[model samples]
Target: MPGATSPLPDLSRPDVGAALFSTWSVGTPERQRATVDALAASWNGRSWPTPELLSQNVYVGTDGDTLMHHSQWTSEEAYLTFVRAHRQARVDEIDAAVPGIERNGIANYRRYRGFDTRTEGDPRVPGCIVAIKADFDDPDPDLRRKWIDLVIEALETDPAPSPGLISADFHLIVSGARHLANNRVEVLNYAQWTSEEAYDAAIAADDPTPEWERVRHFPGFKGTTAKRYRFERSFVRP
Candidate 1:
């Protein structure tokens, strides 16, 4: 990672070949904090044993009931190996501190495209992360690519810069049994913003924008959901 001082993960880091995204529902703001605290303690207590585990960045949803974990790995095989050998113990440790946490299944993805809109001389840091998930009716990779291209075109043709938008990195789900079972392809847009207020302002101003209309009406788009989060902490392997 070029900017070591920043806690935000470098979404386009070349060495990271795979990423795992998971979430936990803790039921309250207090539980959310406890979950993050327990996770940091658990990660720091041990000498990280898996060298392929590049980084684990934790985020707390602004909604007050969720925690998102974004982890980077050298390869999918390395992640599977770790899950088989050490995942249970780590899960148990966190569960001990925050019982009854609802664990959501993990999704695997690879970064496909990214856009950086930060101003050259600006020193502002991203204070909010907006994760937008889009699902399609089919599992065709070409369909996914086409939709992403439409998004890029929309952004590029916009007459003015989107206020508060820092960057957006899109990830396509890795095809596997889980995806086949669901019969849908998923895309995640990991976006960063200068602050929640700026994001809210953009949303308030977003109806009937000509550039976004095409994407909003694009065919084969099943549905989409978005959430805002605050970066809590990140642990990088030594």
Candidate 2:
């Protein structure tokens, strides 16, 4: 986000510049479950350019009724260009899907920071996810470097907070635009583990690794909202 982090990963390449973060609110618990599952099925069937790098659909609900889509593209400019050419057909398809559901706004993110541990994306896999979103203090270069290094180290050390981690992806928002519903992120991270049993073992150990612990105490971030979602996962990566 802040001029890219030193040597970036494949996900951080310039061609991989645009990301879609969206939330859909389906009224009531009953409808929420059905609608989310239906939408996931419908989305998997839709015709559109393949998401260039990544695509994810996650469920997070205290009441068991929420869904979010995280998708990546070549760039914001690339996405804008494609939308201009396909806006009408896309709208028509969406209109048909719109029976009694309300569509929430979307946000575009320009920078991607991924910390690889296990594999990247697959919704069928079962895992425990730790998702954090917050506004960064826009620190000087030194602190930025420090933060990034800690994130990388956190997942690599043996005896990590959770063993058998699959992967971790941290994304930052360089664009100023964002969704209005309690969602504005200078940074967002998603970390996945192999299973709840694996995660429990990490926490049960005598000493836990310092990766996530250290980052949590860093002073450069504020207004952080952190959540843990069980059975949450990223959609199949393209």
Candidate 3:
């Protein structure tokens, strides 16, 4: 795991056209560390032949039983090509190192919008990352777009949003192929905060925010789930 402490991905990077998000249930804190170590070893031990694989980041969940892998790619086509050629062998290598990882299915997405709240003079590094999942009852991509618009409008118009929110990047799950279709659509919010306490304070004060209330009750909005994590390690293409 040497040289594994790299910087997080630039969510607003124009060259990054697609992303893949997946999680694994490792069952214990010890296993969580072991899993991340195994992944870093696998990624850094050899030369990555696929130029399209821009970066891969690993996060250890605060709850002690989960690990999230967020990988950036040049395009979905490149990802598919990599999957066809290299995915399984890599999976086998990792499995041999750390067995019984209950992998959640990977979700594909494209960054649709992003907002950065930090000013020019700010020098704080984000200590917490929040992954928020907004689910809709309908599969229509238009509904997903409308809901995100509402969220952006609410945040933009709010007069006194909680401080310490570094940035929020919204992603829309890609849809089209039969294998990717579902009855529900999901929008993911990848948010960075100065600290876990800052995020907790915002959640405690959520009830009085009129802007948030409007977005919460928007039509077709089903429900949301969120989890917090600290960046564990990352690997970028050499």
Candidate 3 — which residues are off by over 4 angstroms?
1-5, 178-183
lDDT of each: 0.84, 0.56, 0.84
Clashing pairs in 2: 15-74, 118-166
Supply the TM-score for candidate 1: 0.93
Error of 2 at 203 (Å): 5.8
Per-residue error at 81 for model 2, in Å?
3.4
Tell me the number of clashing residue pairs for each predicted model. 0, 2, 0
TM-score of each: 0.93, 0.62, 0.93
Model 2 lDDT-worst window of ten: 1-10
Estimate the overall C-alpha local distance difference test score of candidate 2: 0.56
Residue pairs with colliding backbones in model 1 are none
Candidate 1 C-alpha lDDT tens digits along 175-234: 775431233478999999999999988878775557578777778888789999999878
**Could you give candidate 3's per-residue lDDT for residues 1-238 as a string of tens digits?**
2246557788878888788888889999999988887887778777784878888889999999999989899988888888888888778888998899998778888899887888889898889999999998888888788888878888777787878788899999887773232324899999999899999998877754676777788788899999999998888776
Q: What ranges in model 1 sit over 4 Å off?
A: 1-6, 178-184, 207-209
